[model samples]
Target chain A: MPPTSEPSTSDTAQPTDADALQAEVTRLRELVGPDEAAYTSLKIELWAARDSAFGAEMAAGELRGQVKVLEGQLAQANRNRRWMVERIKAPLRRVKAILR
Target chain B: MARYSILTPVYDPPEDVLRACLESVARQTFQDWEHCLVDDASTQPHVARVLEEYAAKDRRFKVKRRAANGGIIAASQDALELATGEFVCLLDHDDLLTKDALFEVDLIASTDPSLDYCYSDEDYLSPDGKFINPFHKPDWSPERFRSQMYTGHFSVARRDLVIEVGGFRTGYEGSQDYDLVLRVTEKARSVRHVAKILYHWRMMPESVAQNAEAKPWAYEAGRRAVQDHCDRTGRRATVVDGVVPGVYRVQREIEGEPLVSVVIPTRGSSARVWGVERCFIVEAVRSLVERARYTNIEIIVVMDAPAPAGVIEKLERLAGDRLKIVWYDKPFNFSEKVNLGAAHASGELMLVLNDDIEVETPDFIETMIGLIQEGDVAMVGAKLLFADGRLQHAGHLYNHDPFHAYFGYPANHLGESSVLACQRETSGVTAACALVKMSIWNEVGGLTPELAANFNDVDLSLKIRAKGYRILWTPYAVLYHFESMTRIPTVNLDELKVMRERWATPLKNDPYHNPNFEPLRDDWVLRSR
Candidate 1:
């Protein structure tokens, strides 16, 4: 019998070949069923976990991409700020001295 | 039949280095070996000359000159064709095998002829001619191997099995050996380990053996190798770049949402830890609720005295729907409290956490749960750190006195002067933060109620291990254990006696721990003979 198949409870305890085989199958099922159920659940959870991990990785990738783009923009702004500060400083000093 | 077919894929190694490697082979104690040296079209003419010389000098040394540079993997496959022996052993062109390396391997194989794979202990040889970083490895640990190829060299495998696993593939030059080891071991009936340091890995400036970062592509190849192993084995898992370079963090996903019974035993005592006044039970529960990303966890608080009146209301409020208070007013036995908690808990996996512990990682429960859910993994443990940022427990080592590995070691320290930082196999993990399969826990009769304070977890782990299951200590699953932080340490001399009497043999000598190492030390320092 298949490991996943449920036991046939309707079978009688008669001394027939099919009955004996079915009874043996039911006995084996009784032994392995609970463990099989737990294993099945564990497998299902594992798939979910993998999917979740993959999703997390994807989200992290997107965030990293965004951070990289932002970092570049920040660097450009810093460069522009430096240029403006240097260029405007002398003129501002000149204006301040005249005003004083 | 020739016992070993030593495959040495000679590339552009220096002349002196090549000579040393050849000399080491000639010095082997076990003589029945066919050394197949494949020259992978080195730019230097000396490389070919050295191989030709070696081949001419000894009939055991066979030469295979490649037409083009096929890299390490393809060259290894070509060398495999020339191999005519029972077993295949990989030896880097610049690396040296110890004198009795082959002898020890042959002895193990002769004893158990059906053993599919065997490896010996190895250490790196400094350029200044010093033997350093000796790796005293444990017996065949599949999980440890998956974490990182601790079994790096002196790998002796059944020749048929090597070819069956496709010898080796191209493009995995930097970590081709790791890839092959993974594949070959997957189908192996028995994998034995020789604990003696028998392989000398020479460290050169250019070799990946020297610095893993030298070939950054190697990490990606390693990741793929581990992934392929998981896929073939039908395990739901993924491998990612770890906190450090070269080491991999293998993340396994348990398929279903198996309910985790977060059983915490506490007396609800308040203590000022690092200038912050906190109740142990409240904070531990709060962290589990707020930090742990997983949803399927029931926080069962086994309290000694109904959480002092108003504290009970507050705890219930904090825990919300996930709290179940099991009152155990009996004279404080740590084991009984835990056993009572397990009885009350309605979950497949039992996660026993110390009341003083706070979750450091968001995925703490998930990581521990994933490990216990895996087949044949009886229990799971986490790396616990103290409040002052020192290691409280990083797994345990049984010796003359059972002690924690890296105990009192700096929390941020990466295993000072040894290889304790990697994920590894151990006899036991502390119940300070441990996860166990409830079924297995019951089968092992839970913790011995007699050991109320200490050694209960150790005894349980040893019993679980006896049932042919592994107890894993994961560095990935980390937590802050202000260990016995807000609780009293009731020294049970009788309980200690019970544990020592029961586990005298294992306590004296841990199979996972090497006898050569000093019994009382934290790191793998050699005990002077």
Candidate 2:
């Protein structure tokens, strides 16, 4: 209020980078409020979004590893099944008692 | 018209038993037969009544009741004294003769005019007159006859031969008939067999031969008879102890130390390789070279295919001068592989072994060879065990399954612990380990290649049995086996199918792969127990 400066054509045409950044920060602060609780909640929301993205990739990798282990177990099960069938197919002993 | 004198010694036999015996004699095809019934002062009235009735009905039947109650041997001799026929046949009052009994004897005497003595095969009947078993006799030979007397023979011999041998001896009471037969055969110009079923031996609970109870006296008499015959014939006969029936020992000097060729057929696989574990062949051969009790030994390794280069190199490094390799570039056929190996052996005895086994005892070869040298033993098998220390095979039971087949069981365990340990004579041993005389092997024609991988041992055992030789499974000889360790990764369906088919078909056809094994009937196992 001490001295009001007229707006320059360059400043009016496009906002400066530093001025834009500061304006966005002020807008966020106004929406959330200036209290410590609001500030802590805002920080937690940003951290949660980043953590969720990383957790999705890790979960997908773990699922792939489990799938590989399960496939190996299935192959082993089939081999054992075949071996059991073969053993059963062997002929049983024949016994003949002499007519005494 | 040749007259047949039937000498029957009667004790206090039941009326029914005596009637059956007389009826059987009456039914004989040869009508001109005379029966001498010597009664040993029967305490039972039924015996006299039956004998009197039979004597009155038939003119050919004669009765002689003893004044004193003499034993069976004296009564039998009394009957023999009354015999007036050219040929005499010994028959017990409790036993019976088949309808064609006399006809069979007449046929044999007429054909073999020079034959002075003859015997026939017999069948056993229960007291209730039910047929039990047929005791088939092999063709007659002097060596076979002297080695073992299988048939009681309801025999027909020239009267002079019986009299010259002093009929039946008193000392040989229970086995008097055996003693007399041995003496008659010795004195005879010719001895023969009818090879026909002409007699029915009734089995009574108290009968010496029929009863399973101990008859040490009878066995001793039989042993004496064998010894006396040998002494008379100037043949050195040593009673073979620790052997089963149908086995004998003959004294003969070793002509020369015969070289023994050991043949081992192997596939480089870990399962069938004879000495893969603890390097069996390598170690066994090394031991044989280092501590052999016998001087002459040769080791031959027959590979179905070239082993892995590493295995071959190791074997070559261990073989030294005693080992020979015969590469067989062919499919896996155990019998054929053995035959191929035998064809190349330069020894009198062939020792066959499996790849996955190792000889645990050093005296194994010597023990088997020594037994074979005693004569009569055709083949010897080592006791085989599994890696887990259970019996894999001791010997085989012939006709174990009624299908004329044999099987090995309880692999890698102690044989003496098996239920069949009581059976001393085995049908055959697993080809995995066996020592066989090359002479007998050649005479019997080695293993049947048609059997291929399975049951080849049974076929070989049967062939040896057919030659009147015994198959012995020695427990003293031991070997360790790792069974089926190198089996193919996949099951061979075709081989399996063929194995079963071959097993079933031969059993159906032969019904007795080993004639020594009595065919399975319901009563056999029960009676034995």
Give stretches of model 1 more than 4 Å off. A1-100, B416-421, B484-491
Lowest lDDT 10-residue stretch of candidate 1 chain B:
B412-421
Candidate 2 residue lDDT tens string, B1-529 = 2379999999998888899899999898888789999999999999888888989998788899998888989999999888899899988887889889988888878777677888887778876668766655543444334445554757888988899889978998677887888888877887766655678888887765476344657766666777777677665445442233332333323446789998888766543222223454555555556655666878888875657656665666566666788889977788888988898898989888887765667677775675566467788787775543335566654343422111222332211112122213455667778889998888877877666766677677767876777776665576766674235435345644644564554333332122332344211121110
Error of 1 at A72 (Å): 45
Candidate 1 lDDT over A2-82, as tens digits, reads: 578775665574466586678877886686585757656766886777666545644554554455445544654565577
lDDT of 1: 0.81
Q: Residue-wise lDDT of candidate 1 within B1-529, one digit each (tens)?
A: 5779999888899999999999999999889998988999899999888888888989899998889997888888998989989999989988999999999998889999789999988889998999876777777878777777778888999999999999898767677888999999999998998889889999999766678678888878887898888888888888887766667877888788999999999999887554456788898888888888888999999998756655776778678889999888889899999999999988989899889988888898788777776688989898887765556788888876677876655554565222355666788999999999999999989999888777888889889988999998888777888764345666679978997788888787776667666676555555543
Q: Per-residue error at A49 for model 1, in Å?
A: 40
DockQ per candidate: 0.01, 0.01
Interface RMSD of each: 20.3, 23.4
Candidate number with greatest lDDT: 1
Off by over 4 Å in 2: A1-100, B1-3, B14-16, B40-53, B64-70, B84-87, B104-149, B153-167, B181-205, B227-257, B272-295, B303-322, B326-340, B356-406, B409-529
Q: Please tell me which predicted candidate would have the highest TM-score against the true structure.
A: 1
Docking class of 2: incorrect
